[model samples]
Target: MTNQGTRQRFSPYITFSREEWRHLRDSTPLPLTEAELEQLRGINERVSMDEVADIYLPLSRLLNLYVAATQNLYQATNTFLGHLEAKVPYIIGIAGSVAVGKSTTARIIQALLARWPNHPKVDLVTTDGFLYPNRVLEERGLMKRKGFPESYDVRRLIQFVADVKSGKPEVLAPVYSHLTYDIVPGEFIRIRQPDIMILEGLNVLQTNPDGGRKRAPQVFVSDFFDFSIYVDAKEEHIKRWYVERFQTLRETAFRDEKSYFRRYADLTAEEAERTALSIWEEINAVNLRENIAPTRNRAHLILEKAEDHTVRQVLLRKL
Candidate 1:
């Protein structure tokens, strides 16, 4: 079954099966090879070539058409106003719960969109960089809520996207290190002018937090997006994925002495499984229920996945 509200008969989205979506690809050649697919796939996630051909090829083609249409509309509007307005980057937002394969989806889309002739300068950025530094979280007593919306520098993140949307020549985003589980000091990722930009995160689809007060000016990160995608799966499936990924990391990244989770590397298999479950139950699951899942309906498209991490169905919101 699909997520809540998706089951409504009068829903705005048109659901499509995997086979139906695959048929829409037509003659679009798969631009990525097996090696590239391996590089893009996330830990404990399975994204095969067939999966890409069936799901992403058509998505990239659809996005290409949207980009072309948007450019034409921009030109027409400029002509009507008798002014040559500057072209800004087309922004796409990708949101999903942790361990739901959002990173892989964003990376694959970035690769495919960049290969398109119209937008060869596609750039991808994750909201991880916008997260408040560890020191700030600790000071605020929000270390346990690291991935929560309150843990982010929302104003700065919004401003960065606003600058890019306003056709700024260059914008810089802070750098985040997963191994250290913190932001790197004085490090930033520079994004030059590009035809397309993909912003990926767990909270990208969330609305303003004004408690419905209509104040002077309220803007959300998603306001600048031309399109948005939400990767979804059953809560049970996601919990299992998270535990599995945690175990895998314990054997690999957690073994690094400098890694933030180095202590987990010494856990026995049984102990590791129990610890992983406890972390998910106490932290990740709470965040998903209270913050992330509520915003799923805000996406223009929803890719629902199965237990195996394969996208089982596609739901495209009607225009």
Candidate 2:
């Protein structure tokens, strides 16, 4: 791995190599065990205890500090205004291309942050719930662009985040099933007032297309975030990971009778690889290039990963 100085300087972030970032973990003890990691890890993703100690521990510690600082600021503002204000949940947005391991990062951060003494009530919601139902997508001719921003009910998603940020006691969000690859009708996940909420998705950092130029309602999903992270990797590496995950799922989840991708389970290895590559090139790659990657610089932090699925560097946006 190259040192930070050797990397091209382009963004406003201060880059830290893996070793340099790992040193920031300090004395924070790992609260998670191997069994817990197995449960948190996504299919075809590798997350070891060492990786958590090196990468996520420092991240959780930094978030803890940020949460404390934000709370103090809120209290100070209330004091200056001479009025008591309700505490709102600290919202974090995690964005990345599919197979870049943002989901795993979100879950790990949720677990780690929850273990902290200051905030034990942490909730995670993926924007998958914000995706239009499969029938709706089909009706709108957006089935092929399922992960694109247009396939999501952006208004509803923004409303949910707004309500949460407004200190609502309880909020309901639609539930999505990976097995069915669609929203589950009549099902919703209820989140009560949590100390922290992690919203993870490919398009969480997306803004309005017009950039709020046309003075209509101009709320974006990212406006509610107190902090945001983008998990990043080279397109070629992410494409390989996507194909690998597809093959793994074909052998596992896709084999289920009720699985939406059951048809893929019976394909020969060569056919499966070809199909996965085609899907990557046609759908995932296009979305990453046109929609997802563009939001990487919008994140407060960027976790750049190596081909092995391990984060190799940390990029913290300069204050």
Candidate 3:
């Protein structure tokens, strides 16, 4: 295989057997209680309280440390320059394949980190909001590539992150509606300079420098990130997760009258299964291979999941 192919296939110091992963999971502390687990029952059933306590709890604790260290570093830099400047928000980027449990990771991290004493204000944003409106995509003949990099308003996304990192007064991100399968007009989530921002998406770590005789500018979404995480799992496992989530939605979210996917609400189980598989193959899998998976090494930490959606092993980038 070529060098590119080899990197695509594997990463050194980032692989683990299932059993070893289980030992790690077993050794991790569980910070969430049974009552809290019950609270998260419906929204994210795939990841249990045990999963949060064992995997995400520890991860949140580590992030707290990183945030504190960053604050001190910024303060020292300011003191050396003899200028008083407020600390910038610590930005985190989370990347993963479709249905690889990244949204859950983002949400879980948001909740956990908010509970941390040091970082009281934690904001979570998904790149879904950064996607162009469906009308724009349809006008450009890119409706089918909705989750691909080209489907996004990349310039707007970059600007939003840059503004946030720059400590702008307030930055508002467009809100996306899964029900309408489009960006909501005039609806946004405002971030008021939080202590930390968790930005989650498929290709948050992917970067492509401007190609020119003069290096125009090298800015990718990850350029603004203080740290990043890539959620990793076998392709087959992710495919199964996609299908399973589809099935779940068919019974729940798809049934909502306001849901854009309401048309699929009446699909029989077998029909739904087939439709799910087709969508995964055509849209998600292609994006995963072409855009998302290649950026794994760029993350500061990697969470590898198993077929059942449990975090099997974690790979921490060596300091």
Candidate 4:
């Protein structure tokens, strides 16, 4: 579409500005405390409770409300249809760029929503578990494009989610290790009946490759989400975050003897900077541009953040 046509269809996309964007950062009646936030702090320092309460607490509340509304709607439907059966799991998706604090957001929301009396037994599963084993990626010469849509076993992922949403008795998802950056062998996480399931990862919203009858089933992962959130920030800010996270890992996680990235643990400051930027430029940036960013419109809500990693504005899809 031409710029004029695009403008006519998506006026909201072009209207947000730093000066005009304002949402007060305040706590809820029952907010996540500093101790609670500390439990969620990942290997990186970017995620904290203030970030959660200011940004993700509101998001979690919104998701809870959405799930409740969905339940009410389903009950009304059941009454009209004259059938009685328990509803399926409510799925929530979260997408964001690498080093944009997506994992932290997922963990925080999972913890908070579990505390909600209405939606207990909330389980968090990541699409990283759907990634093809390293051997497969190497065989396909796709190791460099690990985060690309093609690198995942999309069929298995879609099937697992479809089964869960269809009220399947049990669904087993593969386990992935951050240290090795690959699927662990002989290990799978079993998700039983749960009130809510939070699916988190990069490229979770990408479309399937096969376009056939059995292959091209329903919508992708984003379709299963009762509510979806995409963390947003300037590209420069994300780049800085990537560099900072890499530095932290060098001093911490990478130092683990069993880590696959252990070789990088001894990298000098200069060498580490070069290595981080190289990976970002070659792999992460390409995947973000070609795969992830395009799915921004598929989200139910967008939390736009500033350079200092604070949410500055929120773009919500009008229902």
What would the TM-score be for candidate 3 when compared with the true structure? 0.87
Q: Model 4, range 1-319, lDDT digits (tens) per residue?
A: 9997787477544333333332332344445678878888665546655566556666667777787888788889889999976558999889999988788878888988887777888989999998899999999898997878888888798889888898787889999999888999999999897999989988777675331224555667667777887887888888888988899899999999989899999999889999999999999988788778888888877778788777777777776
lDDT of 2: 0.92
Which structure is stronger by lDDT: 1 or 4? Answer: 1
After superposition, candidate 1 runs with Cα above 4 Å error: 1-9, 208-217
The order by descending lDDT is 2, 1, 3, 4
Residue-level error in angstroms, candidate 4, position 61: 2.3
What TM-score, computed on C-alpha atoms, does each candidate reach?
0.94, 0.94, 0.87, 0.88
Local error of candidate 4 at residue 43 (angstroms): 3.0
In candidate 3, position 267 carries an lDDT of 97
Model 3 lDDT, full chain set: 0.82
lDDT of 3 at 78: 93
Residue 134 local lDDT, model 3 = 84
Q: List the residue pairs that clash in candidate 3.
A: 179-260
Identify the runs in model 4 with alpha carbons over 4 angstroms from their true place.
Answer: 1-27, 208-218
lDDT by residue for model 1 over 1-319, one digit each (tens)? 5665456557879888899999989899999999999999999888999999999999999999999999889889999999987668999999999999999999999999999888899989999999999999999898998888888888899999999898888899999999999999999989897999999998998774322343523789999999999999999999999989999999999999999999999999889999999989898999898889999999999999999999999999998
